[model samples]
Target: MLETTMPALASLEAFGNVTDLLVRRAADAPDHVAFDVPADDPASWRPVTTAAFLGDVRALAKGMMGAGLVAGDRVAIMAPTRYEWAVADLATWFAGGVVVPVYDSSSASQVDAIVHDAGVRLAIAGSRAHADLLTRALVGTDAIGTWAMRGVDGIRSLDDLTGRGTHVTDAELETRRTLAGHHDPATIVYTSGTTGEPKGAVLTHSNFLGQVLNIAAAYREVVTPTGNTIIFLPLAHVLARGLQLICIASGMRIAHLSEPSRVVPALSVLRPTFLVVVPRVLQKIQAAAADKAARMRLGPVWERAVSTAVARGRLAEKQDAGRRSRAPRGLRVRGAVFDALFYSRLRAIMGGRVDYILSGGATLDGALSLFFRGIGVPVIEGYGLTETTAPLTGNLPGRIVSGTVGLPLPGSTVRISPEGEVLARGVGVFAGYRDPRHDAEAFVDGFFRTGDLGRIDDGGRLILEGRMKDVIVTSNGKTVVPARWEGAVEASPLVQHAVMVGEGKPYLSALLILDPAESAAWAASHGSTFATGSPGEVRAIDEPRLRAHLQPTVDAANALVARSEQVRRFTLVLADLDDHELVTPTLKIKRREVLHRAADTIDTLYRGAAS
Candidate 1:
């Protein structure tokens, strides 16, 4: 039976506005560390107390109001994950304006599209490069009125505005705070537009606050007043922003790291208990660990023994925790030895305090999810979209399964339509996009249509099938789901990404991008000679021998699919799907864009131009 009801919890009546929420927390925990900014130049870290954090937020709010940002005005912020990003986001809310976030990695065109679409009057860019990109994006257009945070030749700086403005009186700030209520639009988040032009999802303060309430209730057992989180995911994404609000509501300390590569080192230093990450990050970590294990050169027997022991240990741990049915004493001992030898080092690298790694943004590979679980790190996969305030369903502690995106969070409702598309409703749902036409198609019977095909299993787990838009119809009238095929292809060690084609064609085809390092290592090991070439050339090697190596994986994928959906032909591509242009920032493949760009190659593959 599906579990749709949640256990009763405390009512959410503390504050009505985001600013009020922050202020109340600050007053209650004035001396507690609210945020930590770790510097890369040295081993030093800068900490912000709740009082100081609120002080900065108030100052920025006053500064924004002084700069003529009135209620309902939109202020766009483009920055990496940092303290200023959070401060600016809250300040924008406190100033009674909507915050528009642009990912730091977004190109000039993307920035321009968001600013123009959201009708941003002011933009706060983080670095000189970001400011430059904004300038380039605004060139030949009058869409943006001003830029701040990072100084440009003519635009004002956030520091300058805050310094020049008079302190906002408490009463005045209070009035503005009250104006920023639940129903008022708080943010305009742009979807990553993998399919087409990005649409701004207009989310109100109520929508975000509802998500915060759901998250707090979902993790009430684990979340503490002193819990610390390492924030590295881009704040532009709703997932990160929603998590940040949860931390604020629960009074968790947030450590902001400037660089992505420094995440492991920062974790070692901070010893944070919680982390939020995408699937790609986990995939890379697993790959690195496997590479290290391979270098140990254990014989087949030894490797088999170790793997068996590790599996037994995991089963034993599950049984002891009462999560599994049973385990033998001898198997438990073998598992313990394997954990001491291999898993312990991995845990230490994660600072040994990480109790949960929240995986979201995209579907995580099931094998990779199980691998982390086997290592004693519980990875809880969740599912959400920008339009739904980030999380609609997530795995609660002790109830997580590898292949599913758990049950709906408290107060959220997810239903599978007769046609199998996922429909969701609750306070967490956004108040529609800014455009009426888009909003009209996004909802039906008051429930938000997620545009993804999925099923609510008997156990209440949400099993995602694939995007409705990504389904391909073969010439033989058989329906093919590309995502399932892509997932299978990517399971191969040789493949990094795959896009299945052949919609309305005779047979299925695929554009495959091989994993460069793995392919290179394989080539070297086999003593196969290739032209000394660029990374692209190395990745695009068509040595018949290389194809022979990948055939087994291709055959396996073919065996898993219907005969009509089987891949009849495939061409290895030389270039990756560029995140900046082809894929969404969340790293989801933009099938239409990729196929359009590689139209000729896809056609050639269908025509059997190259065998």
Candidate 2:
């Protein structure tokens, strides 16, 4: 068994409940801006000071207390990533209630499952649409009350809730806050359910404190008051929620972007020093950069530059390989020229000031990571499940490894089982799932079974091999890991998602979701008509000419793997695979869901000629 652990840092010992950070930050730096909310105009943002933020939390807590929620009661926050979401979240903790987060865009049935399972009675909605969703979710239920952040007809507004708190004294609120302990459930964050039913992890104050303090200590240089960060991912996800807490505890200046589609534009304007995101964002960035290069008729030169950089990267990773064995001087010169011409423009699009981007929730392709690093932006990959309270292992600034998930977080322990499953045990890990019955299946001995196959490298970095259940076995009995091929396929600018299917079938076939913009641009350049389709819909590309254009990308990906594992027959999907139903909130495609929904397409791929 391979195991590694980083001892807990001193910061973890200082907190009582996780909420203490807010109280302390407010006391120490009351005038410091805690968050920046975007105004109606996209170009401007409004700041919220620590003092004002705490006051809002206090008022909301009093309102929640006055509404009859007692200690241990669950209160749901159904909202997008916004200032009000943060206020409601902290207020729930201060009110001595467990925060049960619900995604603002979630369907009513999804919301209903979470609320009913968590036994939630009070939900704070971000908008009228969200209030309506919550209303539908709570129908025929225990008369759950709904409060909207924005004013809505017949729904109580956040202002109204805060107004009711005027009668409640400060001492009473303090008394309620004191009732919460380090072991109390801080939040019931539901998993995105990529594999199966979404399980609620019972994370405690200590669970979050462990992550926040360890991450702070690990990245102390970058976690500063002046650092700017934008919250664009769903706050409902553990990674984003944990990141929000980390930013608040570190006193970083934050901006919340409610729309995910506006992230790149907002980044250019906000010019955040650091960014935390899922791999999909990076994929999009890479695709756009490559598309632009191709449009400029610099594809061959760009490819050569990327190849040289990747070679240099691989050589540099070796023990005695640095400048001594770097790429040839001529190649390096050409790369530097291309970096100025192409890569710099890409960096400028992201505001040119990003120190380093921290990505988790999904694996970033190794080549893509190296390409970004070559272009002067380091995209660090981290790994963790929702049950681990955000991140249990990640690539920090100095110790980054391109393909690996760096090292275990300070205070966490990771071990590889005989079967290659990664098991974790530490303060960062949740005690268990919300359902006691799942404990036996989730934990092996004392370690939390990650259900992911991975190995610990000699350097102590963890390399994920993909989910155990996701392994595809052919009728010939050759075992294949789809993520291995999928990661390579996604590395191509033409592909958005490359899902391999053929479990118990003859050979592996792929369901390809081409990057619409890039594919369209390629088609247009090749003298073919690329028609537009509905929003997020992938337009049909069944023509032989389009397939011919995509063949080189497919051949490049196939070169990375063995013949059996290479995609045999392929079918192009006409819609974005990143759709909510097909992918998790964190952006990992739900392979089973996609296969089930696209059974007809899979059958067609198998029956049709190989692309």
Candidate 3:
């Protein structure tokens, strides 16, 4: 049985003012840097002192009020991660309007769906491109209006909003700010909708504030008030948005990066103390570093010797530094050398002072987690959803366990039902979905059912097993979970991602997407003839060769699963899953969609029709 210690649930009573939170922080740290952007070209950053940020926020809020946006009106913000995005979100709340966040890359149909669902009255787009996406979607909808951050055809710009600012008196502005309350709907964040139509999760100002407060208390022991963080993850997501709030309240400097490739460079320039990243970004960095190390031929003997010396230095420093319990001796040493040989360059790429990396959005591969720990930069994996305002549980710096998602955050309760689904009730929980139908299905007895299968161990760590909705049941009534098998298949050097399919079928099969760069290198090493082909041709020519290489991996994975759960066969995909279309923006695999699109190929694999 899992034991839960939850703080008394805070009341949803209104705080009666929203700008009060911002005003308090601004007064305390007026000159402290609030946000920075290292990736924006001219490659310069826009640094705002707390007072300046607050000033801009107030101006924007006043501007919205002058434009006739009343309390509870929905203002949609669709843009990439930038200072403007944060400013708009806060401004909406300050003006007592509910902010609806839409992804920058969402297609026309997706944009239409979200805007229509949220009943958005005025949409604020971040750039000209963002405005264009919305314009196409709002072709005939008169109920919705659009505003562009940059001036665009038939749309109002930020300048237009600021132009009307002089018409509003100080007393009028105060009234708008006073109308803002903690219980007011701050934002309606849409779920990724991997399984079906997306539903809007209604997060209130209090819900977001509670998340920031809980996380701050949880990591107060390690993170100092003077810490700085580089923000690259999408602010449209709850994790990134909540992190921004935490940074503000904690007096930490924040720098935003737009392009992912610029993360290393931005880090080098910012020298931030912390970063929040998804698993895919971390995996890419690890793979890149490993490839570089292999090419340099830094073999075990030299590596071990260097690692040992580095470890000793770290241990001595930790002893002198007078921190609480030091990290594992092996990890300390490996981190030291990794820092000395690799992390310095990595830090140089980041700007050098990163103290911690927070991982979230999906389950991180255990091997990848171990590798990151071994190298010395601790990657703390967290678990949450938009409905939970992002932080339900997290593995902190010193108390981390390799395979689990750590314990629940303060004031949060997590329970595993008889069916193994993780249910949560906490201060961070949202005010239910906007749709009554979704709200009914999403909650059971006041507990928000996560629909994720997981187990809590004797030590209280939460290990996520798989999604209840994605579990495959064979015709013989045997259950085969895709995540467990997919993790195993991905462990193979040749397989990048695999989608296991067997629901209502006799046995399991898969659609495999090979990692082009890794597969090509393996082909070259093995003296295979298809090493230099284009991505499509490489996949086509090397299918047989890859099939041969993956046989042992397949057999090994099968040993761990039941016969019905085992992958009976697989077909290599000729093209990568289209990031713009097939895959979600977060890079999560859409199983049902993918299976439907690849039905012919899947049928061929099961019928043994392909070579």
Best by TM-score: 2
Q: Report residue 209 deviation for candidate 1 (angstroms).
A: 0.8
Q: How close is candidate 1 to the true structure, as a TM-score?
A: 0.91
Candidate 3 lDDT over 263-330, as tens digits, reads 66566566778878887666667556656677888655345533453454344334533655566776
Instruction: Count clashing residue pairs per candidate.
Output: 1, 2, 8
Model 1 local distance difference test score: 0.76
How much is 3 displaced in model 2, in angstroms? Answer: 1.5
Better of 1 and 2 by lDDT: 2
Off by over 4 Å in 2: 308-332, 516-541, 576-579, 608-611
Taking every candidate in turn, the Cα RMSD to the unseen true structure, in Å, is 3.4, 3.0, 4.6
What are the per-residue Cα lDDT tens digits for candidate 2 across 490-568?
7666777788889888878887777767777677887876565565443445768767766777787788899988887
lDDT of 1 by residue, 271-330 (tens): 888888887677777656666777787445345544654464356346644775565776
Question: Residue 53's C-alpha lDDT in candidate 2?
Answer: 93
Off by over 4 Å in 1: 1-13, 136-155, 299-324, 492-494, 515-541, 576-579, 608-611
The weakest ten consecutive residues by lDDT in model 3 span 533-542
Q: Residue 434 deviation, candidate 3, in Å?
A: 1.1
Query: Which of 2 and 3 is the better model by lDDT?
Result: 2
